[model samples]
Target: MKKISFIGMTLLFIACTPIRNTNIKTNLLDNNTFELSEISTDATYGTEKNPIQVGGVASNEGPKNERRFLNALAGPNGEAVTYFRAGSCCPIKSKNDPFGSGSVMLDNYRVTWQGAKDTVSIYINMYDSGTLKAPKGFTIKK
Candidate 1:
């Protein structure tokens, strides 16, 4: 009985221990830049092809929810879009047309996550006539 109780306690302790935190590599390559390549970009919406900036967390995720990575997209025409509270572990299941700040012309602009076949790669579709920029800590999907 004592041995069984000791084993139970040991199991509980192990379970309670925090696992090693997974982080998005801030410096993806040899360069210490958090920027990721744009998976796809289209200038067909307008004559201007907006520029994109990227970044992400080096480490940190929470229980029941992963750390949020913010992707900011901005255009030269004073338009900007931000993907807020984006989940790292799970793909967004549905499409959403989130409104942007007044400076951006992204009303009813649709965003869809096509699901990730690879954890290292994120698959997303966005209709942003504006530019995309990420925080000092996040990056766009390469």
Candidate 2:
């Protein structure tokens, strides 16, 4: 009974552990990288006042690669920004597209920076022509 309990506990621990993918390469426009001090996905999207989104399918990149690329963006004042995977964008059917010829997946991420006064939201596009770089007026940590 004790052995069984130990095995069950070990399995539970492993199952509950969060896995971090270290093999993903950073693919920001300028090779920019940022340390995530805090991250959350509890925000709305597509609203009139706070309309921020980002991301789309890359030719040879998957969601994991896209996330790694986005992890490198910093806040306006160099504060750690939060990422929210809002959803996908319009669908495109192209037989020659790398992301499968039937549907083009565009990922939308709502990036937010919590400042002293208030929170700011920025929209990002990860479509075919999406570029991974800090938006205008925003700065990433060197």
Whole-model Cα lDDT of every candidate shown, in order: 0.29, 0.49
Quote the lDDT for 32 in model 2. 37
Query: After superposing candidate 1, which stretches have Cα over 4 Å from the reference?
Result: 16-18, 22-30, 36-142
Q: Which ten residues in a row have the lowest lDDT in candidate 2?
A: 45-54
lDDT of 2 by residue, 1-142 (tens): 9999999999999999976332333344443342322333324332322222233344444554446545665676877777777676655543334546565545566666676355444443333332234454455545
What would you estimate as the lDDT of candidate 1? Answer: 0.29
Writing each residue's lDDT as its tens digit, candidate 1 over 1-142 gives 9999999999999999976322223333223223334423443321112322111211112110111222222322323333232332322221222433222221122222234222122222222111223422222443
List clashing residue pairs in candidate 2.
53-123, 53-124, 54-109, 54-124, 54-125, 55-125, 55-126, 56-126, 56-127
Could you say which candidate leads in lDDT? 2
Q: Per-candidate TM vs. native?
A: 0.22, 0.45
Clash count of each predicted structure: 13, 9
